[model samples]
Target: MRREVPLAITFITGFLLIIGFFIPHDPIGGLQSMFLQWYAIIAGFTMVLGLMTLTRIHTRRIVKRTQGFGYSVILIGAMLGTLVVGFYSGIKYKGLFELGTPFMWYYNNILVPLSATMFSLLAFFIASAAYRAFRARTIEATLLLIAGVLVMIGRVPVGNLIWNKLPIIAEWIMNIPQLAAKRGILIGVALGMIATSLRIILGIERTYLK
Candidate 1:
């Protein structure tokens, strides 16, 4: 009964949403809005459940003194500290997300810098990957290597000094080939999503229930 009920709900909700997209009338449109609001409320509760699960797992790890327990301890401490500061600021300032609040300060000072550092580290990995991928083992790889080098050079002022048309050539390659490739990928993704959505709506994809 549990499985059947959820499957029925999923089919109804998905079918209604599809209809609402095409026929944006009073009842269907209103139902769509109500469903969206319900989704948001459910999402909020889901996030709370996820937070509780995370805390429980980390607490268990700490209790067991398992390997990497120190990192788990730090994660739990930081999460709790952030939540406390956020709640306190929300009550004191009547807005949790206002500028200059303690939560915002922590976000701006700590979180942003950490995020930047992580992305900066990606540059090295990207360089390594580029080196491996650009090896001229075949005609295609050779062409790709040449194009990459040209694009990189065109982005710098020295490329302009060496050849005046290099930047224009680079821009053409990006606007034509890169944009076409990107559009092809997006079309493929859209088609895949449509197929998956249909499978779920038809109850062929039941793994989500588990």
Candidate 2:
């Protein structure tokens, strides 16, 4: 009965939303707005649920004294501290959580530097991976290697000294090949989304319910 009720609600809601897109009338539009509000409320609850889940998992790890348990403790402490400070301080003035607040101080000093260091480490790892990948084994690999080298050089002032046409070639590769490939992937993704949405509406996609 529980499963059936949710499935029925999903089917009805999906069908109504599909219909509402075509018929932009009074009752359907009103229903869509109300549904969106309800969705926002549900989303808020989901965030709370996610935080609870995170706390539970970390607390269990701490209790078990598992490997990297100290990291878990630190994560839980940081999360709870951030939440308390954010709520207590109150974010006023549009994305700036109250000047001279504990939240703002923690965010600016601690969070920003930590995030920057993480990204810097990520760049180092990415460069190492790219070096491994760009070996001139095959024609395709050679072409990729050349393109990557040119792009890297072209972005700096030294490339102009090396060759006048390097920047132009780099720009052409990015604009033509890269942009075309990106568009092709986007089109495929859009088609897949449409297919998935249709399947969901038709009740052929039941994994979501599960």
Candidate 3:
């Protein structure tokens, strides 16, 4: 009964959401569009669940003096702080209009910088990883190495000056190999999703809610 109820709710909720996208005139559509605001209200009301869960887990760790418990404290503190600031922004801002003067400060400065830093980190990681992967090891590896370098160089002005053929190499990589591989992956993923969806619809899969 416990498991069944959650599964039923999930199934119904998902169908309604999907249908709402197709039927803009329906009440389901209206409700779906309004769901974000409704969610914030419900989330605010239900925050006690999160607080209790965090307290239960962390309190146990703190009591036991467990390893990395201090990090947990910092993590929880950051989460709570972000939630408080975001909520206050919504409230003090008053429904997407007229005055969130104070909260906008945090949004613009803190959130923007953090987002920029995250993106910069990802770019750095990609460059470093690509450098390590693309070496003249084997035939396939050499091709990958060559393709990646061409793409990287073609993206900027200096690359075109150094190797006039780099752009053409990048174009072939993008048009043929990369495109074919991406399509194959997308088809496989779609088939997997379809299979999983059918299993859920037919009650063949029951582990989803868990």
Candidate 4:
């Protein structure tokens, strides 16, 4: 009964959305907006569920004294601290996310800096991956290495001093071959998404029921 109900809902919702896309009339067209509002409400509950799940997992790790438990403690502490501040600010000032509110202050000062630091650390990993990829083992790798070096050099002022045409060549490489490859990838992704959506709509993709 549970599975059947959800599958029926999914089928009806997907069919209506498809209909609304093609035939934008009063009865069917309004269903899309109403469904989107329902989606937002459902998403809020799912977010709360996700937060509860995260806290539960981290609390278990801390209780078990697992490796890196200190990190879990810090994570839980920061999450709770942010949540409390956000709720308090929302009730007190009637705006949790206002520019000068405590929530935004925590977001701008603590969260943004932490995010920047994480990304800065990720640069070293990217450089390591690039080093392996740029090895001149094959013709394609050699071409890639050369193009990468040229692109890097052309982006700098020193490259202009060395050769004025370096930037022009770099621009050609990026605009011509790179852009074509990127567009092909995007088209492939769009096709894949359409296929997946169709599969779900047709009830062939029932993994979501699990």
Candidate 5:
């Protein structure tokens, strides 16, 4: 009974949202707006569920005194602190986000740098992987190796001294092949998404868990 009601609501709301994009009538538009409002409410409730889960898991870890327990405490403390400060300063006081608030400052300074540092650290790992995989033992590997080396050197002045072809090769590698492959993969993904949507609409897939 608990699951059945939610499932019914899910199906009804989802059907409305999909049909809303096509229908032009005022009644259907109103129905779409109502369903969208319901979806927003559901999303708010789900956010609370996430908060509860975070609190539950962190509280357990702190109580058990497990390894890296301090970091977990820091994670929860930072999250709650930011939430409270942002809520009061922005929503309650300004009725909008305060750009100069400490919460915003910490997000811009600490969070952004930390994320970038993590991503930048990948450069070394990528270099190592590329070193192993781009060996010129085979014809395709040799071609790929040449392309990579050219692109790497092209941005530097020494590449011109080595050969004038490096910059042109790099341009083709970056602009032509990269864009073509990316667009092809994106198109395939879009088609797959459409197929998945159709499957869900016809009840062939039951992945939309309540």
Candidate 6:
């Protein structure tokens, strides 16, 4: 019954949404909004459940004195601190989680800086990957390497100083080849999604039941 009920709901909801897209009648449209609202409420509860799960896992790690448990301690402490401040400010004090509040202050000063540092590290790793991948071993690889270099240079002011036409060439490459590649990828993704949706609607994709 547990498996059957979820599958039944998936099939019905999938078809209703599909049919609603084509029909656009009042009842179907209203049902879509109602379902979306229900989804939002469910999502909120899921977030709380997720937070509890995180806390449980980290607490277990801390209790067991696992390797790098210090990081888990920091993570749990930060999460609990944020949650407490957010609830206290918003619920008890009738203040908001807005810019001037402690919640936003921690979010902006601590979280944003940490996130920016992570992204900066990511950019360094991306550059390393590009260097390895763009080795001019083949004709295609050479062309790709040249295009990447041109784009990188064109984004900065020195490329214009080096050669005025470099920016124009870079823009052409992006607008023509890059745009075409993106559209092709998008079309493939759309077709794949349609096939997967059909599988779910027909109960062939029952992995979700687990």
Alpha-carbon TM-score of each model against the true structure = 0.92, 0.88, 0.68, 0.90, 0.78, 0.92
Clash total of candidate 2: 0
Q: Write the per-residue lDDT of candidate 4 for residues 1-210, one digit (tens) a residue.
A: 978888888889999999999988878889887897999999999989999999999999999999999999999999899989989889888587887888889989998999999999998998899987899999999999998988888889898999999998888889998899999999999999999999988889999999
lDDT by residue for model 3 over 1-210, one digit each (tens)?
Answer: 888787776677667667788997758888777775777898987887887788789878877889999987876776777678777767767653235454576667877899999999999899889878888889999988877778888878887898887777788889999999999999999999989886776567888666
Q: Candidate order by TM-score, highest to lowest?
A: 6, 1, 4, 2, 5, 3
Candidate 1 per-residue lDDT over residues 7-106, each given as its tens digit: 9999999999999998888899889878989999999999999999999999999999999999999999999998999898999996877998998999
Question: How far is 176's C-alpha from truth in model 1 (Å)?
Answer: 0.8
Q: What TM value does model 6 have?
A: 0.92
Query: In TM-score terms, which candidate is top?
Result: 6
In terms of lDDT, which candidate is stronger, 3 or 6?
A: 6
lDDT-better candidate, 4 vs 5: 4
RMSD of 2: 2.3
| Model 2 regions lying over 4 Å from their true place | 91-96
lDDT top scorer: 1
When superposed on Cα atoms, how far off is each prediction in RMSD?
A: 1.7, 2.3, 4.4, 1.9, 3.1, 1.8
- lDDT tens digits by residue: candidate 5, 26-141: 78778999878887998999999998999999989999999999988998998888787767677655544467876677778877999999999999999999989998899989
**Model 1 Cα shift for residue 23 (angstroms):** 1.8
Report residue 67 deviation for candidate 5 (angstroms).
Answer: 2.6
Candidate 6 local lDDT, residue 206: 91
Evaluated at residue 132, the lDDT of candidate 2 is 96
What lDDT score belongs to each candidate, Candidate 1 first? 0.94, 0.88, 0.78, 0.91, 0.82, 0.89
Q: How many residue pairs clash in each candidate?
A: 0, 0, 0, 0, 0, 0
Where does model 5 exceed 4 Å of error?
A: 1-10, 92-97, 155-165
lDDT of 4 at 25: 88
User: Ten residues in a row with the worst lDDT in model 5?
Assistant: 88-97
